[model samples]
Target: MKKITNAFRLTLSLILIAVVFSGCLIREVEQPATVKTGGEFQVKLTITDKTADANAHYGAVCVLAPDDWEFVSGSYDSQVGTGIFLFDSSAKPVYGNIDSVLAPPAGMKWIKLLSDAAFTNPADVIHEATINLKVGQKTGDYNIGYFTTKNSADLLGSLNMSDEDNDNAWSDTSMNHKVTVELAVGVEDEKVVPTKFSLDQNYPNPFNPETTIRYSLPVSGYTTLKVYDILGKEIAVLVNGSKQAGQHSVQFSANNLQLTSGIYFYELRVGDSSASDKSEFSEFKETKKMILTK
Candidate 1:
């Protein structure tokens, strides 16, 4: 009888060890290596079970986002849950009995993704969760935070973790993900502006009912384009308005003007205009001559 009891006790101990070992799991995050400012990108999370338990499952995942980024939507797993919770810079979670979406703490900004059902299928290599995000206008390397949970509760003490330490929390493991951003194509740097002002001669000069006038402004100010006869008489005001510091063009049609074919001069002027007064750039004037024929 003593021998039988010893054998039974040993068997029970081994069974408990197997159960504990089967619950070991780790999270891996995959995301785009780089993205452009204001562009949308995808982040993928793969959860791997070291224990290979068919019954192991997770209900939620909490992620920390970089500054200037916002949560878009996330991929939904019907096998897991029906809906997900969206959080920004300010979020607080309830530690217990998280059935639905829980708001983050006041002044705490975080992003929590939830599933109604639960992620399972340990037989598969991994379970996946994908989230969409929008990149902000800043350019630099950004880090993302990852954590696992059973329900809406604090699964990995993520709520208590600070944003500064969140990215480094998983650095020891291979679960860290960094996203790189650059300025979008064709988007000029905010610090750059025009440096010199100049005007180009009209094209198709010397003979035509219509001509094109081009000019450049070194600074943002009021500008005007006037057409005058060779005798110094103002024939028409082609352009009179505020213009940004850049190259601009205006097309002039002589079809409506009641003038015979002759040589004409076009002038460009720039100045600072006040709200109470319509100023002119007359002090800074440039002229180019063109000819028109019937």
Candidate 2:
């Protein structure tokens, strides 16, 4: 046997400790039970860093979803939990797109999430964020799987990752995190009436040129849908003087208006404008956010 240096032994011990205590794991995942076809939904993820003592390291979360579902860039990076690294997808490993790089499955893809968020210091620290995505025309029940990696050994963008990472890499399929997409039937499907007033999030957000805004009306009256800039400045009026008690959609085209790219708000005022008191006349008033990418 060859003589081993003291430095070598100490270094080996540290590596083993990291592998054992690199406690980064997804603690919980929240997803919607049902979403309309071609509608947008969000996934809330809670990740915990559990260790006796903390080490300065990084972690990542990968979501397994069908290829038909589009990943819409939204606030996943903005609302990272306290003491977490700055979450950013721009740092994603780009070995020729995520699908070809991770090779999820025949009909699905792997969406990897990373953070500047850290759990350094006392153990048991956690991080939270929401991922936005849009469903396609397909309507069916689907399972969403999650995979996590901790420790400094396999940081995201690590060139060392091999080609073997695929559907097999995403685990815990039985966790039962599933989303069901129902067929989208418009107002033409008169059999189905909306139980309550609601406004769905815009799909393909951070959209350039055009995007569609959808709203539901339990009881019909006069309605007006208008777009406003971040400054509360009125931008465009997409709809006015509407009727019918059913789902409705309006297309907003920024290209035609020559509007610059920025965050915009859309307000839905449903009720009667002919009434003396405008506030009391309105049955419902709701507003939602959408991003414009010129």
Candidate 3:
């Protein structure tokens, strides 16, 4: 009976080995552990395995973003996949069989999300989205996750039940497919600010190829900083966007515009963005003179 016992022990060991090897096929999404709200930040979506694996092809990916955050823009370096994003107030929370045809049905607001195009190498796919805190957004922790629609075997049409060949690697298929991130909102309130809007004179006035212009805003608003020649003709737009209430600076490069040595004026215009005091700062504009030698 000793020979029989040895054979049984060997068989049991082989079964345990097969079970352990078959458990690590799927992968989870990784991202930063924390992000600051109010300020713009990037949400990166990447797989654990960094190597460009040959079998990592995915047909579709769906990402569910936090409801309170505002969608800014997608990362400029999105890999070979087209994306569709939505942010509708009338949208409702929709979660279910992500692979189902009706998962992301029409009109789902409050959820800023992205649906990716098919035919992508999972390992090579690195996605990023820029987001910021919605006006008056509360600070807290949030989770962001994605679900893949098609696995490697499902893409290549080699679906099988058992891992006899161990060819599949779609390991992470949990329901809560997300990573947690802490968001600290309203942190800007404690920061200092100027009492009023002001624009300072550019340094190195007679600059060779570049000069710097400094300006400050007392409150959050849309700002426009433009460079104009002595004749009031616009030379270049240095800054044109919404900015927080703080001191800001931008550089002027005369090398690209082929601007000759001459006197130029820079102007700063501020427009109210808050609905409560929309007309309070309608007439905020400042101008400063600068000279460029070469």
Candidate 4:
């Protein structure tokens, strides 16, 4: 029978080359959920080998933040294994290298690593991984992600991935990649309450004897800040007490008051009803103008 039909076609071509060189196939080229608190975000994970035969390594991609947001320090960097690798001496085919690692702690600020070159070949492969957050004046929502390893297996327990908000889902199959990030907490309003009562103008303005007079009281009353010299009398008070509406700054050390420069005036008072009615309170007075160069 022609030697058993050529030994059954060489045993089905070595069993289809051992089922295409076994397993290991990760995927996830830039998985961004959404990022916009301080701006800057990126994510990408990939590992393949349907039959490329050997070559896929990844270790280091851990990002987790939520506590007002703060990670702006040194900033790390790594685009898939540092570079330099091209072989073909005699059919050493095992190409498919990709690596991207980053670690940002102690203030956080390591942005850049979505893939610079790992096993490259994700239908063409692409890379991107960035992180930078600093928007917290008390608002709301936030979450982050990242974690993976290969060759020794730990693909973050199987790999399916899911994150609508931010909680650490999981994904890793040698390189089946996956990512998630969400940050939504608005309404900072620039802070600085004190909508009406005005009095601001005393910063370095011809200041040599000291300057810094700002005032604004709209509600929580019982306040007072004084400083006068251009024929107004009162030479020092700074602040009296009670103050809690937002925006407050006091520092006018004129060195015990000697008097020798030019114009200077700063006054602010609030103590009518102490803001009690349903109006949340509103009783303020203002006055500003400073210039004391000596």
Say which candidate scores most in TM-score: 2
Mark the regions of model 2 whose C-alpha exceeds 4 Å error after superposition.
1-62, 72-106, 112-141, 146-174, 179-191, 272-276, 279-282
Q: After superposition, how far is residue 152 of candidate 2 from its true place, in Å?
A: 13
Model 4 agreement with the true structure over 30-83: per-residue lDDT tens digits: 333333444323233333323222355432333344344443211112332232
Question: Against the hidden reference, what TM-scores do the models get?
Answer: 0.38, 0.54, 0.34, 0.19
lDDT of all predictions: 0.49, 0.53, 0.43, 0.39
Give the per-residue lDDT of model 1 (tens digit) for 1-294.
Answer: 000011111000000000001122334444566677775555555544332334534344454454466655444333333333323222444333222323222222345544433444443244455555655676766544444444423333332222232322211112234455777775453224546686655654444688777677877778889999989999999888888887788988888788788778888888875444556354367776676778
Best by lDDT: 2
Q: List CA RMSD, all candidates.
A: 26.3, 13.9, 19.7, 24.4
List the candidate 4 regions with Cα displacement exceeding 4 Å: 1-188, 192-202, 205-212, 216-218, 222-224, 229-232, 235-244, 248-259, 262-291
The worst-scoring run of ten residues by lDDT in candidate 3 lies at: 11-20
**For residues 68-176, what per-residue lDDT tens digits would candidate 3 score against the true structure?**
4444333212454433332323232222233232243232213323332233343434443222223123344443333322423332122222312122433322123
What TM value does model 3 have? 0.34
- lDDT of candidate 4 vs native? 0.39
lDDT (Cα, tens digit) per residue for candidate 2, span 147-231: 4444354333332132132222211111334456677667353345677787655655657888888788888777888999989
Give the C-alpha miss distance for residue 160 in model 4, angstroms. 53
Instruction: Give candidate 3 regions above 4 Å deviation.
Output: 1-191, 275-283
As for lDDT, the candidate ahead, 2 or 4, is 2
In candidate 1, stretches whose alpha carbon ends up further than 4 angstroms from where it belongs are: 1-24, 49-58, 76-91, 95-109, 118-125, 152-154, 157-175, 187-294
